[model samples]
Each structure stands twice: as C-alpha cells, then as structure tokens.
Target: MIESKLISKALFSDKSVKSVNNLKDYAGIEYIASMNQTHSDLVTFVKSSAVYDSDGIYTEEPKLGLVVKTADCMPILLSDKKRIGAIHSGWRGLKSNILEKAIKKFDVNELSISIGPHAQSCCYEVKEDVKKYFNDYTELRDGMFFLNMSKVLKDLSEKEGFQVEVSSICTICNSSYNSYRENKTTARQFGVIWK
Candidate 1:
C-alpha cells in the first residue's frame, strides 16, 4: 500500500537524520536514502539499500518502501501491490516522461499509480518557450497553456497496462497545503509517500 502525508515540523524536521528516523517510525518502513533530485530524467533500480536515490526511474527492490518528497512539484506513486515506487515529477520530469519510463522498467503487465497534489494548470502558468515544447496537437487558448499531467500519466500508464488514480487537488489553490508559489519566502512542505 502507498500512503502520503504533508509532513510538519511537529512530526519531523528537514534534517536528513531526523527525516530518516521519522519515516521509519511513522511508516514502519526503513529510510531508503533520498536522492539528489536535479529535476532530470535518470532512473535507477534499487535492490537492497534502505534508502536509495535516483533522478527518475526505479525498479522493484527488496526494500519494504520507497519515498519521494515534493513541495509545489508532483509526487508520483507506483506499485504492483507488492513493490512500490515514489517519484518526484515537476514540469521538467513530466516532459522527460519519467513515469512512462518507470512503467517500462517493470516486467509485470499491470500496476497501480497515483499522482499527488501539485501546481495545476489553473496556477501553473509558463513561458512561451516552455509551451512550445508541447506538441501542436495539444489544446491551448488565450495565450494560456494547460497540461493535465495526471491525465497524461494516466493515458500513458493505460497504454503500458497500469491502473491509475489521480488526486484532484491543486496545491497552489489549496491554502491548507504548502505551495512554493504561495509562500515563496516560507518553508516548503514535504510530500512523502511510502509502502
């Protein structure tokens, strides 16, 4: 199973030591070390480390859990109901098709996926250059470009034979949730998932 929570300082701190310990306690899953996320699309396959880091892709490992953290960015969860994966996918990661690549890594014919809260199109305005990266077939209007990342991932997952569930919450619009856009000068909330 996969579960996510907006971590608070009262629950844990940002420091590596505390974060790792807290994950173990809260989720009963060991801390597979966090990766140095550069927003790139490099996937890794982990087998034994309690904590593992990757830029994008991760294959099934023996670990009881995997975790990824996000603020305004998206947190993608993948699992076969046995092995689980967590990915931090922002605009850059999405363009790279990190989720698609991860799905390709598995040999199984089916899996379950979840796309967590993120900056939705309503608030995720971008520059023309960025918009140009999308195919012309995409729908666009009034100088605004909207990308349903969850739908995109769902479609991709279906193509690869995985069942997907999407959470219809926009972090920027939800004041209860932490958003980099809403609180530029404040601390960002951690989006953590583990199984």
Candidate 2:
C-alpha cells in the first residue's frame, strides 16, 4: 500500500489548493465542477457544480472547485486568477490538444498550470508509432519506446503561454499513487483548483 499523506506541501506547484482525504480542497471553493473525462479534447465551462461528460472544466465562479481524476493520466490544474480550469490529459487528450481547447474558454491572458503526479517517461513505455505524434520527445531503449508525458504538457503549455509546474512523483514508479498502466487498478487521485 502507498503512504497516503495530506497533499504534500513541498510537492505542490502552486498555492491555489490542497489535498483533502485523497480529495484535495481548493480554497474559496464551495462547490466542485468536474467532467466525466472521455479522453477527448472536449472542454466545458461549468454553469453549476454538476459533473458532466467531457475532458475539461473551467469557471470564474468563486467557491466552485475545478477538479479532475487520474491514475496514470495527467491531471492539469490551470488558473489565471480570473478563471480556473482542470483537465484529464491522457495521451489521447494531449494528442488532441485538450489544453489548447481548455484555454480557449478563457480570454487571452497569461495562465498558471500545474501538472499533478502521473506516469513519467522512466516508467511509461510506449510504441514506436507514438513517436509520430511528438516531434523529438520520445526516447528509445532496447528497441522499446518510453514516452515523456510530462514534457508534452510542458511544451504545449509553453507554446500556449501558460506558466507550468509539474509534480516530481511518477505514479507508476511510486506506489503512493495509483497507475492503471502499472497495476490496472481503478483507484485514482484527484487534482483540484479554484478561482
């Protein structure tokens, strides 16, 4: 079993939120806004606290937390102070530019993005075909390819002008978090933020 601690403070990239009972609570957030996460690029602006079928959620509404759940996939929290959003950025979601879609909902401005714990290149092996999707980020070792999922998000965030911070933990390598790729488990950790 993994040591489940209250969200590590040193591990946090921002001060927008904190983990609570495997469920992080964002400051000033009274309600929670999330998506069903279909691994698509679909991003929705939430009107209420209800969860819906989509990959991303954002809002300017105070006291409403924007959250996403992930095991191996990346949970990205975005905040520009004026608006906050969250996305379940699996490989499929990245390939489709879900972050880009999520940013569209907010007006043109700089943003802060944080990538929560997830599977990293050292533990996330992939097929050679995945290379075509990325320019020069994939690596080869003993004829097997390992994908740098974190880099993909960082690069994309840079291109979109969003300042980014990433968690150092790898879900697959560290038992503290769940990884469907490592154990095929359904357990997940939540990444939450608020505006």
Candidate 3:
C-alpha cells in the first residue's frame, strides 16, 4: 500500500485486489465501501460499508474506507479534513466528466486530490473511435493516437478551484501493479480513503 503525503489516511494499493480488500489487517479500517465501478458518471454518497453501483464514492464517516479498484484506469482519492472520496476514472468515466461529478460533493477549496497509478500517455494508446470523447487530450504519434488522461483530470480539478497531485507511476509501465492494457490482466489494485 502507498500512503499519501497530503493525507496519511488515504492509501493506494500495490497489492492484488483480494489482498487490498482485507484492509483491516493493514489499514486498520473497520469497514470498506468499494464501488461497483461501471465506468459511469454515477457518484454515490456513502455512509457505511457496502458495494454501490457507482464509479465514485464518498463518505464523511470515520473508519469507513472508500475503496476504488483499477487495473490501468485511474484511482483518484479525494479528501478534505472531514470527508473522503474515491473515484474510478477510465476513458468512459473521463468522457462522462466523472471527476467533476465527484468533486461537487465536497468544497472545492478544501479538497485535496490524489490520482493513483494508471495508463499514462506513453502507453495509453487509443483507437480512432475513442478519440471523439477526448479530442483535446489526444495526440497522434507515429501511426497511433495517445490520450493524456492526467492532463484532462488535472485541468478539470484545477478549474474547479482545487489542486491535484497525480502519481507519476504508470500502471502499464510498472510491473508492480496490474495493467489490463499491458497484459490483459483481470487483476486490479485498490485506492482507499477514510476520514
């Protein structure tokens, strides 16, 4: 698990999906509320631990870790002093403006955002069909097109009056974390946050 400097309670999992679910052993979290994560724009306000059909989940309750699982998709953790949230942002989520929807739950000025490992521009190649959703963030290199999701995420968050600290680690480039694009792996890592 990787702890954040901005918020010590927030953690980005380097372990497998199964191991990360057992947060009690490592994070001392009593309950874990993980999202179903359909890559949609649904943002759910959570009070306790339960699976919700949402790509973004937030909580004001203490010890209830908001977990987001991802392979190559971005795992974003949002926290103020009292509330915490987690978001699963892939191409679909970004297109749907999932980050904008998630941050609206909290005071933007008080929000501290952290983006975990994901497929970066260096390896996040997309097809012509996917380019329509992100024309501003995509670039043509050689014969392939690459998407800069970090720029889209940061720009969106900053425009909302908050700053975002994005992780430099790219899941596709790092063997330590699972990458669906890199190896078609079914495994996913987790990002957790608690009040």
Q: State the lDDT of candidate 2 residue by residue for 74-176, as single tens digits.
A: 8887776478778898778878988778777765356667788888888888875676786567788888888888897677766776677887788888877
Q: Model 3, which residues run further than 4 Å from truth?
A: none
Which residue pairs in candidate 2 collide?
A: 29-63, 30-63
- Clashes in candidate 1: how many? 7
**lDDT of all predictions, in order shown?**
0.59, 0.71, 0.86
lDDT of 1 by residue, 78-175 (tens): 66644566677877887887877777665445566666677776676666666666553244768777655566676676667766667667777877
Best by lDDT, which number? 3
Question: Per-residue CA lDDT of candidate 3, range 1-195, in tens?
Answer: 678877767878774547654765678888989888788999998898799999999988987888888999999999887789999999999888888888889888888999988999998999989988889999999999999898997787667778678888889988999999988988888888876
Residue runs of model 1 more than 4 Å from their true location after superposition: 1-20, 48-53, 57-63, 135-142, 185-195
- All candidates: TM-score: 0.75, 0.83, 0.94
lDDT of 1: 0.59
Could you tell me the C-alpha RMSD of candidate 2 in Å? 5.1
Q: Residue 42 in model 3: shift from native, Å?
A: 0.5
Q: Which stretches of candidate 2 lie over 4 Å from their true place?
A: 1-28
